[model samples]
Target: MSRPVVGYAPGAYDMFHIGHLRVLERARSECDLLIAGVATDAVVLSAKAKHPVIPFEQRLEIVSSIRYVDQAIADPHVDKYLTWQRIGFHVLFKGDDWRGTERAHEMESKLESVGVGIVYFPYTGDVSTTLLRTRLSVSE
Candidate 1:
């Protein structure tokens, strides 16, 4: 606890909405430095079975520009512990949506073994990129 806190929040920031901003801001508030990981287009497609509306570079740039983010990286992997090992984050931040799932349970187990902190922010499911995409596609 004496060491400076480094926070990480990884996501597929497709449309970069206020919800993303809220999480990043909240993460920033809890740590000395905050790193935002933008999921790569290939990773997103492989994992989600759909390409993001905004390209990877654009999404990375957008996340980097946010005031709350100290650094941004393109994440090609889904393993949160691997990311933690690579970045040496003191705390792992995620949306509350993953709070009770198997993935969350797995991550909590891994982080707990290493004494790493895990925090989940309020999920803003109503203001997600999926909803935005659905609304846009209908209009078009």
Candidate 2:
């Protein structure tokens, strides 16, 4: 029997929106099981240089409750290979915006070498937490 495909979709998931749901839905459709990794506040701060609008625990809770996510876990590492080592996922799901970046290339190389594949979903160009934040700030 073939092994079940375990997919991992990691994100900060702050200020949850339809775009996040669509990615999770698509990721779930392609895999037998979808594991969503919610980046902790510290991880977000370190990577993005700004604190998440929502707290880590709250963000985790929000992602965990998504119907498309079979499992939700805290993602504390900036390097996806480290997360792969810990989670042992068969595939990684990400937004296509990362498709051509250096970090994406590096991650693809490392994960592919270990027999893990990456699936880039079409990014929801109309919405994002950054855009929301910017709009809110401008209105205030």
Candidate 3:
């Protein structure tokens, strides 16, 4: 029999929102198992230059509780290849926002070389943690 399709969806997932849920749900639908990688505070700080509004532990807990996520773990690496080496997922799920970027292209090349595929879900443009933070700051 063919191996099960395992998908990895990595994100900071700060300030959990419906958009995040939708991505995870859609990712789960496409794969037999969905692993949500919750970026740690240090990883978020290094990647986005800002710490998450929610604590890493809390964010992890929230993601772990999601019905669509079969597993949740701290994603400490900035390099997707490293995560793949560790997790060995058959596919990677990401927002379409990264679809055409340089980083995404690099990632696509690397992942494809290793027999892994990437699936980009439609980006939820209406809301995001960055927008929420900006709104909060403006109101404050």
Candidate 4:
């Protein structure tokens, strides 16, 4: 039997929007199964130094409800390779915005070392949770 193509995409899906939906949908199209990793509140705070406007539970619930995401997992770490170790996904999907950065290049090497391909999707224009939060703050 042919092996199923599994894909893993990780992010903090706070204040869900089309950008998030686009990535998940695009990721799903490339694999037989798509695993969306919802970053935990602590993980978000640690990595981004800001708490999510939507709580982790709500974020997971929103991500779970997305039709494109086959499954959702609570992501406790930022190490993509480690997530791949546990999930055994064949492809790792990341936003094209992260492409060409030093850290991204390093991450690509790590995933490649384990024979996992890295695919970068074009970042949606004009919308993101961070921008949403900033707009909300400005309006207030």
Candidate 5:
């Protein structure tokens, strides 16, 4: 039997919420297997230069527990192309919030060369971890 299409999504996945669920739900629908890259705290800090409310280990555990995700892996580096190549994934999925931007457009071009496609799902604008954090701060 042929292996089912696998979709990979990489993120810090901290303080999981509706946005995270939406991405995973859409990814699962596009492919039989959905693999997630739970960015380590070190990686998140390197990019954002701030500590995540939830630590890497906790975030990894949270994402792994989600039923939609078939597998969760640590992503210490932010190299999207390399991760997709290493995992041999046929598609890389991300939120459309980054769509049409120079960086994402460039990435799309690069991935197309190697026969892998970049799929962008609609981004949930109103609800996000950032918004949740802000609300919590106000409540406190």
Candidate 6:
């Protein structure tokens, strides 16, 4: 039997939005299973100035509850290659906004060496957690 294709996406996943769902749907289409990496509190703080409104454990539970997600894991590190090595996923799914960029180029070089392909999906314009947060902040 052939090994099932799996795609991995890592993020803070705070207050999941349409954009996050789009990525999950696209990733599911490209692979049999989708595993999301919810960044831990420490990792989120290190990566961004603002901490997630929803805590890491809640974020993990929320992401895991999504129908499109097969599994959810905590991402202690933001390195895509390191996550891939740890999970052994077949493909890494991310937004096309990162494609052809320096970071994407570096990730491709590293993952390709391990036989893991990278699939960059088209970003859902004007619909992201950041935008949602801004809207909510103004409404309050």
Among these predictions, the greatest TM-score belongs to: 2
Worst 10 residues of 3 by lDDT: 97-106
Q: List the global CA lDDT of all models.
A: 0.90, 0.95, 0.95, 0.92, 0.86, 0.86
lDDT of 1 by residue, 75-139 (tens): 88777788888888889899998899997899899987888899999999789988999999999
Kindly list the per-residue Cα lDDT of model 2 for residues 1-140, writing each as its tens digit.
99999999999999999999999999999999999999989899998899999999999999999999999999999889999999899999999989999989999999999999899999999999899999999999
* Runs of candidate 4 exceeding 4 Å displacement: none
Clashing pairs in 1: none
Stretches of candidate 3 exceeding 4 Å from the true structure: none
Question: What lDDT does model 6 reach?
Answer: 0.86
Total clashing pairs for each candidate: 0, 0, 0, 0, 0, 0
* Tens digit per residue, CA lDDT, model 3, 35-93: 99999999999989998899999999999999999999999988899999999999999
lDDT of 5 by residue, 1-140 (tens): 99789888888887899899989988999998899999888888886686799988889999999999999999877667777777878898999988988868777887788888789998899987778888999999
Quote model 2's TM-score. 0.98
Q: Residue 16 of candidate 2: its Cα lDDT?
A: 97
Of the two candidates 1 and 4, the one with more favorable lDDT, higher being better, is: 4
Model 6 poorest 10 in a row by lDDT: 77-86
- Model 4 earns a TM-score of 0.96
Off by over 4 Å in 6: none
Shift of residue 40 alpha carbon in model 6, Å: 1.2
lDDT (10s digit) by residue, model 6, range 1-101? 99898889877888888888888887888899899999999888886778889998899999999998999999998678888878899888888878888
What's the CA error at residue 115 for candidate 6, in Å? 1.4
